[model samples]
Target: MKFTRTANANWKGTGMEGTGTISTQSTTLNNAQLSFKTRFAEGVGTNPEELIAAAHSGCFTMQLSFLLTEAGFIPEDLNTKAKVTLEDGTITLIQLELEGKVPGISEEQFQELAQKAKAICPISKLLNTEITLSTTLTA
Candidate 1:
């Protein structure tokens, strides 16, 4: 399946001093504010890194869920957090932390499936940086 999604950003003034608003096609983020303060400093808005983290986490978790179903294991809960690290104006690493509770699945199987999801998820594939995964299979 091939599809496309888009978000729009509008900025005014210089990069350090300029402010912008981002609006997604789905309207989940309609005219959300973003600026230098939001990206590099503390501010009440969203930033690019945060958005990427959200996307990565969501994508990885969904891919894992699909793999689990395919493997005949039903997941009770799966929580994932993606951390995108930016240093020196370059994205350095992305860390994915996952906690999962699945019935009738060995820890080894869970880890293997999560590793596959990390490698195959669309966002994971799109990122051109180091990616790490830590998984916790819970009872």
Candidate 2:
């Protein structure tokens, strides 16, 4: 399988005053300079790591939801947060924090399902970093 997304950026002045655009025929973009990556978080567009984190978090949540449903414990709400840490200019760690309200399931089962989700999620498989999952079953 193959996929692609295009982003365009224009630098008017120095590093600080430059801007960019990332469009997938999508909702919106920014005028922040997201070139070279060093200018990240400096009034520029969202970085690659940030987009990756968004994809990872969304994928993991969907995976967990599917697992919960398959396990016969339909979740009332599923929330996931993914933190991406950069190591040596490459992504090194993806930490997933999950909280769900799932009735008729024990903590152990929730943990088990979460583990499966972590392993089976497509985004987790794509990432080369270690993934740690912390999950909680809510009332």
lDDT of 2 by residue, 52-125 (tens): 88889999899889888887878899999888898777788888999999988999999998999999999999
Candidate 2 lowest-lDDT run of ten: 24-33
* CA lDDT of each prediction against the hidden true structure: 0.97, 0.79
Residue-level lDDT tens digits of model 1 in 1-139: 8989999999999999999999999999999999999999899999999999999999999999999999999999999989999999899999999999998999999999999999999999999999999999999
Residue 62 CA error for candidate 1 (Å)? Answer: 0.3
**Steric collisions counted per model:** 0, 0
Instruction: Compute each candidate's TM-score over C-alphas.
Output: 0.98, 0.78
Candidate 2 deviates by what RMSD? Answer: 3.4
